[model samples]
Target: MFNVPMEVLFKVWRQKPHQSPQLQTYKLEVQAGNTILECLNRIKWEQDGSLAFRKNCRNTICGSCSMRINGRSALACKQNVGQELEMASSSNNGDVPTITIAPLGNMPVIKDLVVDMSGFWDKLQKVDPYVSTQGRKIPEREFLQTPEERSQLDQTGNCIMCGACYSECNALTVNPEFVGPHALAKAQRMVADSRDTEVEARLETYNQGTQGVWGCTRCYYCNAVCPMEVAPMDQIGYLKQDILDRKDAQSSRAIRHRKVLIDLVKQGGWIDERKFGVFVVGNYFRDLQGLLSLAPLGLRMLSSGKFPLSFEPSEGTKEVRSLIEAVQNHD
Candidate 1:
């Protein structure tokens, strides 16, 4: 932390309900020890009383201060002015260094640096984040879990529902029905709990449509911006693995896509684009509707000479197959 004060430019996104949003710049001389939240507080207290944002503990725990800082979602309370200035300097080409603050993405803004989290909460509810009702029946004492079982819940339990992961989720941006990473991370927590009797039901629900775990595009943006180091994308992967282990390819096109992708890779060390669509989306021509849905894309690919007519096995196919089999066996 620098004791010397430095003048930093803050470009904050300003929007009121039913108003066009724009950046409003604020100049402040701040010490490096001051957090982004502190600067925001100073701005509101001294510079602009009309400025709107949310805060609670003035620390990271409450997660109320989550917003975009320098183009990425994070908790403002956790970010120091020093770190942001250094980051801004690197990208600013020696121009005046500036920290850009905006409300979290993938949610509607209520005001400057504040977003409506109703959708975030609704998606979280869809995952049924609570432990199974059966497991919660009035017990004589606390429900117990082994050390190993408890360990599995540690990372996901760290989530404070800050909406950072939700803001960065690419799938949620395009597919409103897609439950964001925050929900799936919580779902994984419930699934990992030994006391949860609804394990199968939860897995089935998570495996269901684009709204569930299958919807994740694996962009890893959620993981990158998570404040608590929850690594939500990794939790989503665990959910997928659990479903893939129990469910067959015929369960759903999503399952088929995963199974076929792995099978093709095992056979040729990489996906066979030609066979992939047939087996996955088309379900080997068993589903006429699925086949019909592929017609437009198939015709376009063929017309553009982008369709592969033949398949060639990779030189390391045997090694790839062995590695996959080893993982399966270990599991």
Candidate 2:
């Protein structure tokens, strides 16, 4: 089958540095097989010479043309005009199939479709994304990894640093300190490396307050929008489990929160709210500040008549316990 030529309406976001953005519309005659980058190139060359966007290699490998295509972050060089039209047809009931192109989210836009990625790079550095050679003797020869160890790095190794996952991360929207998914994904790569000598230290860094893995909201937007299928959210989960395995519950509030929640669920087939706060935030009456901090929330819950004074196990509590035990044993 041959790709037929069609006229498509392009709604492109236009903006100058430090200026408000606006959608500028253009009509282009394009072939269905033409990639979104190709269409943008033609538009810049023929329709509007002043139109601005970033491109290099005109291939997905460079990850230079990543943008919000039709409200989702993706690489323009990989998405074709036909796919956009089909997607629009399914979601849009308008007369014409329209493609809206805009710069990536959660970053400052430099121009029409170019975003400043300084924060993205900075967050990646915060995770110590590279292997550490500190405190290691000089290798006589090349340090080698077994096939299994090498394979563990395959998924994260594919990340092209496209910023697609970072643009769609919901956690970063509310918490700027939260290291974005792209960074966490790379952090997992470092953790999985056999040659890396800083596993314990890396876990400690990643477990530090909301600035690390604890901050992820697990909205899974990063997993959905990642063109390379890095599944950064899943990587975050791996990091969390690694921390849980190595550290005690009293190490931090986040660690206590997870351990306490699981223990409560196993005990009563649900969370015992009355004990949850005392154990997690209050640190089992060990931390005076933590205990005092829970007072206001506890009083508010009591006033609203939402506080659980008594605990009862749900039906099939044994079955739930068995399931939990099964999963723990499997892990």
Candidate 3:
């Protein structure tokens, strides 16, 4: 019960397309259980009529109210004023607590706290995230799945498409072509669905290059920012596993990366960095084209004094080998 209300200050980001961005502070008296969205509504309704933000479902399901609260991507509709105050206080050594609100990152801000999500949607489409069919005749009845197959869909099916994971994705920042985690997470739902018919074609499409699951840096920020605990990174991992199992494109660099990383880590305590590229990208220097493909980068590294000449076995090889063996055995 919010018997006593507290005055909280929100330093919200303000910007319009083709204009400068700034933080505008609004001090409001908010009740304890009031969500950050409620406080923003109060600010717009009472203090500032010109303020702008996006919201549809006041509940967390619609995911329209996703924004950065205290430098982390979260649903403003789900985070209460009390929790934000605690975070702000702890982060700044117990001074007057101030909430820092900003638009989600990695997308062009269209207006104050509103980002253009055309690219996000485009990437989702690139994955062909929907279930595919070859237009076969419909069954007499519904195409049903067993409980065991259905259970696999549970984790990824909760995605609300909030773009929180996309906002925080490090891989997308590095490679703009990389599909965001939201797409991959939803794509996995279709991948696991027993009713889907075109599983092989889907796997082949996703296995080609950095544009798919391979582009992920595995930073796990997508998992951390997700409000529904969809764990997009884990979903991407599942997609990777599926791709590997299907062997759709075994010669793909993504496959090579996984294969080489494991083999190298097993051989030495860690990646040698020297033999990694030669082994993975160069196909162990066996494929002349692969070796020639890396020639430019290797020459650049050599000229810049960055290329490594030799690598020795790591210090804790035995212990590392045992741990690797244990994990392999468990699997």
Candidate number with greatest TM-score: 1
Instruction: Please name the candidate that would achieve the greatest lDDT relative to the true structure.
Output: 1
Q: Whole-model lDDT for model 1 versus the true structure?
A: 0.90
Off by over 4 Å in 1: 89-95, 133-135
Clash number for each model: 0, 0, 0
Residue 171 of model 3 has an lDDT of 94
Q: Per lDDT, what order, best first? A: 1, 2, 3
Candidate 1 vs candidate 2, TM-score winner = 1
RMSD of 2: 2.3
lDDT of 2 by residue, 7-117 (tens): 788989999888889988888888888899999998998989988888887778988899999999999999998888777635342665689999999999888888899
Model 1 Cα lDDT, one tens digit per residue, 1-331: 5898777888899998889999899988999988999999999999999999999998689999999999999999899988887776354524556788999999999988889999999989998888885545676558877899899888998999999999999999999999989999999999988888899989988988999998999999999999899999999999999999998988988899889999999999999998888899889889888888888999999999999989899999999999999998998
TM-scores, all candidates, are 0.94, 0.92, 0.87
| Ten-residue stretch with the least lDDT total in model 1 | 88-97
**Over 4 Å off in model 3, which ranges?**
1-3, 89-95, 133-136, 248-250, 287-331
Error of 1 at 202 (Å): 1.1
Question: Which stretch of 10 consecutive residues in model 3 shows the poorest summed lDDT?
Answer: 88-97
Error of 1 at 111 (Å): 1.3
